[model samples]
Target chain A: MKTKKIATYGLLVSLAFILSYLESLFPIPIPIPGIKIGVANLVVMIALYGFGSTQAFVLSIIRIILVGFTFGNLSTMMYSLAGGLLSCLLMILFKKLKFFSMVGVSIIGGISHNIGQILMAILILESASIINYLPALLITGTITGTLIGIIGGLIEKRLKKFLVNY
Target chain B: MIKKNDFILIGIILAIVLLIWSLSFFKINWPMNFFMKTEGSKVRITVDGQEYKILDLDKDTTFSIEQENGKFNTFEIRDGYVDMIDASCPDKICVHQKEIHYDHETIVCLPNKVVLEIIDGQVNEVDSVAN
Candidate 1:
């Protein structure tokens, strides 16, 4: 059982990395530095509900490291790390709260992720002017985050059944 | 099945999208410069505010601009240069897009809360177009 769990987690990590990289290929055309589709979070969401928070958290970290090594883009890696960490934390918190449902948790996680990246940007730029972009980022973040979260939620539900049977 | 709250949230989202879409036409500003000149045309760009320009689009001929706010704004060339593009803003999402190509469309730098759009060339159409 232990070996199976470890192998399963490894598979999930690889799947997540692939999904994330695939999503990265989608050209947003905006070129605002660090905007992404958040597709890999779907896997995180699945792991969160189906595999448990601890497992999901582990998967997230591993995925982040793999992506960072593969892309070798420091700026993107920083954003991903900050955003992914905050998002995972938020998702877990919201899940515990049981207030808005898993989808809501995922959305909130997405928003936190963007905000984290923006904050990181502000610090790196050493200019408060970047804060001006908050409203716009928030608006976009919420919209995209929600969509991603819902998709993740659905996948999580489906995975729950599969995991139980397996 | 989506709950009533989810339904309401969706409605709210639609309303916000519509509102933002409509507000996009309010005033789009593209960062530019009339005084700065490249090899041939005038340049309009946004920088760290250390450098700025005042362009007379109607009075100058062959003007060029360098983007200041990165990808926040888009530019278009018509009788005059206009900024029209989409953005990542939930509201300003369409505001900070690629600048336009025709006489219409504009670029907006929402992070800078700036809008760059085109105006009628009637001010000094030929004189400014030269820059």
Candidate 2:
């Protein structure tokens, strides 16, 4: 790998880690567990669009591990890992299909992330009733995903010129 | 940069949201209520999926549990409603959740592995009339 690629990887991973830490500091007012704006995903989305799936996947895994150890426990790590992996895979697939724009892909990412976490929660808690939170989670995920996608789209447009050199 | 397919995707999601929202809403409000007049008479508490205690909602009281792992949760039943009053969990999302009085409603403290659910208490006059 080129030095520039390595540096980009480091930069994106650290940015994602910092974003996760910052997000944990400010809890969303919603009472639902595992609900967040997913600001860190913005970094992953950018990496996926700018670089490729492999880079995005690596960045996501490293960031999740770092954030999980720093701000959360083993169970929390499991939840994050599940959500991150599902969201990254789905986003990559959607991007490849070329049917939807970044906004649409991000929306799918957000909703799937919530679904993935909720499924993990159900498994850990052994309660099917916890699925009651699905509607609210879906709505919030859609809204936040749209916001992140718009911002990411703008950033990618500007970064495209510089990224080509690397 | 929003494409036509983006709108289509969002529309499909919204349709799903509406379908689910209405189904759950009507399940609680229309058919069940119209048939039997079900009311939540007992609050069932569980920890780690095991039954902990079932408290009568009619008697206003406070209950607290402290696990060996140092996780703790406290709740109160007042005026036929159950409310999570305190917890050792960092988020305390359960405490902030709205108090529940209807059957099938729940307050969950995920960090503490605690769940409080409103269980159907009595079959009222509606059931007899229908029968």
Candidate 3:
């Protein structure tokens, strides 16, 4: 990657980090656990569609870490890490499978992140009882993920007019 | 076509969220837990997938459950609470949760694959009599 490209990616990552933190400050009307209107993810979904899977993955992780550090809440870091990794992985995999469109990838990413985090919570708690919470998380994930993805796809379609080739 | 798909995705996500929220919100009654622990020589329990029950009593016995390698983790009961003490997984979030004893409380350790809860059971004879 060229230095200029690296700088651009870094900017993208920073921008995403800021957005994620900002979204955290936004109150999600839904009271469901793990439900969020993560506006930062909109950028990530766009990057994945316009750029490449690898770049998007890097962006997601950087955002999570940056948000985690800024908030100084090391405890919830694992949840973020697990969710981010799973979402990115699923998005890329689905993209390779020709799964619908960028919006679809974002939905998959959102749902997978929730599933991954629940799995993380289940494993940590040594209790399957909480599995009942899945339906709620998945539901919220789908809604938020799809919304972000659609926004991303729109942005990507517009950005395609530029000289960027993923 | 992409626009239509986006609408469908959005609709699906919204439907799910609504369904889940309604179910969670209107849940009139909580479910019961079958694995209730009693005071005995051995406190056998499962954590994450490993089964570790403690013998030789302590101040306040707390059980932490975790799972590892498709097996339930056996946690150590210490300090009137439970801790992973040892595990094979890379993350140990369950071990960090504070001990819980209330009927509705639960301790979740994600890495170890354990979910320790105060299983609902009939109160003991003495407590039952008191009640």
Model 3, retained fraction of real contacts?
A: 0.37
Q: Give the alpha carbon lDDT tens digit for every residue of A1-166 in model 3.
A: 4976787698788889878778778757543335667687787777777778888888898888888888748656787788778888888888888746776777788888888777776555555556655666777677777678767767777888762742
Give the per-residue lDDT of model 1 (tens digit) for A22-117.
Answer: 977775755454466677888888888887889989999999989988974886788788888988988888788776666567667766777788
DockQ of each: 0.06, 0.36, 0.19
DockQ of 1: 0.06
Residue A59 CA displacement from its true place in model 2, Å? 0.8
Superposed on all Cα atoms, the candidates' RMSDs to the truth, in angstroms, are 9.5, 4.9, 10.3
Model 2 CAPRI rating: acceptable
Question: Which candidate tops TM-score?
Answer: 2
Best by DockQ: 2
Q: How accurate is candidate 1 locally (lDDT)?
A: 0.61
Off by over 4 Å in 1: B1-131
Interface RMSD of candidate number 3: 7.5
Error of 3 at A45 (Å): 1.0
